[model samples]
Target: MTRYEPAVDLNAITALDVHVHVESDDHGHFALDEELLDASAAYFKGSENRTPSVQDLARRYRDAGMAAVVFTVDATTATGHPAISSEEIAQAAAEHADVLIPFGSVDPHQGAAAVQRARHLVQEYGVRGFKFHPSLQAFSPDDPAFQPLWAALEELGVPALFHTGQNGIGAGLPGGRGIKLRYSNPLLLDDVAADFPGLTVILAHPSVPWQAEAISMATHKANVYIDLSGWRPKYFPPELVRAAGGLLRRKVLFGSDYPLIAPERWLADFDDLGIDTAHRPGILKQNAAHVLGLR
Candidate 1:
């Protein structure tokens, strides 16, 4: 099978958004359940549209002079809701290759089949990375059972992104819809980083209550990175801001958890932070380019 490479003309784009989501597939099925969706929409107060199609996102980013890495989470085994087709997302990304890069997701609970599907997504769909939600998927990243899944992605030379810290997926609900905060602990990924030396792990968001851990992981492991997303920048933990301006400058990538958190809002708040203007380009795009092999 031919691995799909996106057809984007690098010269035309100004930024590479690393953490956008394909909440709805081409078939019009949502990636999350109704109640949880409503709660998150209300929590984030998203105004730019809660759910977007791959084509819709491609057009939006292309017109905005940006490129986006897009994907849907597959939590079928955990949530009982079937996952959107990663292959379909890949096919659509190919159509709008100039602005879209596809990422793939599989419920880790499926064990070996999950690992197999991940391989298929990379080999057949041209996914450059994978997404995992520990809390929402009811799994821990350090669990020995998931080592194979991580190993397979490691072998493929594609990065694996894990949702860390506070989650809006089950936020504000009683018991957060049974999503446990412990599952998203950044410390768990430290173990994965140490165990899988070659695997590039992205710690998504600030990791909220575990911000310190996220900082330590990025500082300790050359392969671990942090994507500044999921929260408005003005509210970013002070340590994260310090790292962005200093030691973790090149390791932090700009990512707006778009549709939930708008890029305009995130960028505006980020500008107010007084980070060195010289490093802005890397945070905004170049760093992500290094991660994506786009440069």
Candidate 2:
């Protein structure tokens, strides 16, 4: 059980991708079932390899001159699919510490066990943060039952990255495979940010249909941030584009939701967003550095 630690040189890296996923382990086990994986692949129309290992991610990110925060979702209770071990991911990432930063995930439905696992991941495995998929996990972020989990993350002083808005997983399937989209609404995280002010909350993706709410929450809460993942920048809502260039410049971070949306494609589209040139550096790297405590 090797502990992972980041050795990324902020000056040398062009970007920090804060939302990449480790879809498969070395043994060829996938994080999601075939149905959900197929659904997401169809939705994104992605051509890149979908189930890349930790080593694959490391090679890709290193070749691209970028650093990535990699993780796998632990939706065991909701999806009934076993998750790739975050511990193994962390240990593998330790070998490529220059490019890969591991983030741990735990099934929120596991109650106290989840909280203990989170601490173990951080303290023992050296995970820098955690990833949560409310829609896939089928839990309301504001539910009181998960407060202890949030409190534990806050106590650890690491950020909580939650999937917000529409999810590609289970998309186009009958009843969307019973994954509730309502659970991912960024507004639900408002209660969490308000309650756990010390824990940094990263609302992943654009939060379409609720972009305004996401922007409002990030604007209203000092600890709240938004990651520009899961959507091409050209498709970003006008208000979000404006906010990223102006008031929310320091509150937005770059993320490509890799494997589904390639960083190269995301960056190409981003160039067309007309963001202020002065804000580009901060949006691409500086803001994420601060949010991840790398600064």
Please state the error at residue 157 of candidate 1 in Å.
Answer: 0.2
Query: How far in Å is the alpha carbon of 274 misplaced in model 2?
Result: 0.8
For model 2, the local distance difference test gives 0.94
Q: Give model 1's TM-score versus the native structure.
A: 0.97
Q: Report the number of the highest-lDDT candidate.
A: 2
Model 1 residue 171 distance off true place after TM-score fit, in angstroms:
1.4
How many backbone clashes does every candidate have? 0, 0
The Cα local distance difference test for each model comes to 0.89, 0.94
Question: Compared with the true structure, what per-residue lDDT tens digits does model 1 show for residues 158-274?
Answer: 999999999988778898888898999999999899999889999999999999999999999999999998999999999999999999999999899887987778889999999
Q: Which lDDT tens digits does candidate 2 get at residues 1-295?
A: 7898778899989999999989999888999999888999999997489999999999999999999999999999998899999999999999999999899999999999999999999999999999999999999999999999999999999999999999899899999999999999999999999999999999999998899999999999999999999998988999999999899999999999999999999999999988888889999989998988785
Q: Which ten residues in a row have the lowest lDDT in candidate 1?
A: 1-10
Residue 159, candidate 1: alpha-carbon lDDT: 94
Task: Flag clash pairs in model 2.
Answer: none
- What are the runs in model 1 whose C-alpha is more than 4 Å off? 1-3
